[model samples]
Target: MRIAMWSGPRNLSTAMMYSFGARADFTAMDEPFYAAYLKATGLDHPMRDAVLAAQEQDPALVPLGFVQDGTRHLYMKHMAQHMIDGFPLDWAEDCVNIHLIRHPARVIASYAEKREAPRLADIGFDRQLMLFERLGGLVTDSADIRADPEGMLRRLCAAIDLPFDPAMLHWPAGPRAEDGVWAPHWYGAIHRSTGFAGPEGELPELKGAEAEVLEAAMPYYERLFAERLKNS
Candidate 1:
C-alpha cells in the first residue's frame, strides 16, 4: 500500500508520520516534494538550501520509482498548502490520500511561536480550498484521529484497506532515513515523542498582527473544512 498523508503546517503531521513508520512492515518518507518545489520555484522558504542539499545527497528523497515491490506499506507526509506546483496531485493516483487539518487559530499560534512568516490566509485559502474540494474523499481530520488515535488508526487502515497493526502506534525514539534532513531544527519536540498524544485545547490568545491574520483566515478555513466534512 502507498499512502500519502496531507496536512497544513503545525497540524501534527510529523507525529503522524512517526506513528505510521512505527509499524515494522512499513517504510515511510517525509515531504520529498518540498526540496523539488524549492529548487524549481527558487522560493526562499525557511531552510530552503538545506532541503535542496538533502535531496541532492539522497535521490530517494525525491520522487522516483514507486514502492511497488519489497515494502508492504509506504507512507509520505505532505503539507497541503505546499501542493501549489501540482507535483503531489500529479501522483495522487499512485497512493491513497489522507488529509489532516487543525483549527486555524491553533495552527497560527503554533507557527507564530516558531517565527514563521506566512499565515494560512497569505497562502491563498481559495487554493487550499480547491485542493480539498478536488481531493474530497481522501481527506481526514487530525482532530478526529487525536480524539481516538487507536480507533482512528483502525478506521484509517480500513479506509485504505490495510490491516490495523499495533506496531503502527509507536516508533523507536530518534530519526529515521526518510525524516527531513531539517528534522533536527524543525521537529525537535516530535522526535522526542514515542506515540500519539490525544487532542489538546487551543493555545491562549494570539495577539498582534499574527492574530489578525489568523482571524482573517478562519472563515475561509471554515468553508473548506465544512465542505470537506459534508463530502466525507
Candidate 2:
C-alpha cells in the first residue's frame, strides 16, 4: 500500500511525515518533487540552489518509482503546488491520497515569516482543492490533528484502510534521512516537537492583500473542512 499525503505550506505535513516514519512498517518520503518544482518555476525560495541540486529535477521520478526495492506501505509527503503546469499527474491515481488543510489565515501568517509577500497560490490552497476535486479522497485538517492527534490519525488510517499504529502519535526529536534539503530553513519548530501540540491561539490580523487572499480561500477550505474525518 502507498499513501500520498497532499498538503500545502505551513501545514502539519512534516509532522505527519514524521509520525508515519516512526511506524516500523512504513517508509516516509519528504516532498520528493520539491526539487522539480524549484527547477521548473525558478521560485527564489530559501536555499533555492541547494534544493535544486539535492534531488532529481524530474517531477515524475518520485511517484513513478515510489516504492523502490519493494518497500510496502510508503508514505509520500507532497505539496500540492509542486504539481506544476507541465507535470503529468496520471501517476497519482495509483496511490491512496489525503489532503491536509490549515486555515488560510494561519497559513499566510506562518508562510510570510519565511518568504516575501505571498499570494494565495504560494500557500497551495487552490492547488489542494483542485487535487481533492479531481482525485476524490480523504481530507484532514491540521487543526483537527493538532487538537486530537490520536483520534484524528486513527480516523485517517481507518478512512484509508490502514491499521492505526501507536507510533504515529510520537517520534524522536531529530531529523531523519527522508527530510527535504530545505529542512533546515523550514523544519525548526517541528524538529523540536516530539508530538502534536494543541491548537494555537488565534493568529493576528491579515493586512491588505493578505486579507483578500484569505477571504478568497475560505470557501475552498470550508468545503474540505466539512469532509474531515470526525474523531468520534
* Candidate 2 stretches greater than 4 Å from native: 68-71
Q: lDDT of all the models against the reference?
A: 0.70, 0.87
Candidate 1: regions farther than 4 A off = 56-62, 68-71, 86-88, 121-127, 227-232
For model 1 the local lDDT of residue 113 reads 64
RMSD of model 2 against the true structure: 1.3
Most accurate candidate by lDDT: 2
Candidate 1's TM-score:
0.84
lDDT (Cα, 0-100) at 219 in candidate 1? 77
Worst 10 residues of 2 by lDDT: 62-71
**What local lDDT score does residue 14 receive in model 2, on the 0 to 100 scale?**
94
Candidate 1 CA-lDDT value: 0.70
| TM-score of every candidate relative to the true structure | 0.84, 0.96
Give per-residue CA lDDT, model 1, range 1-232, as digits (tens): 7887777777788988888877777787887667776665667766778888866333234466445438567888876655665454656665677767677777776776665656553344545566666765455666777777888788777777788899877877777766887787778777777887777886557778767777777776777566443212
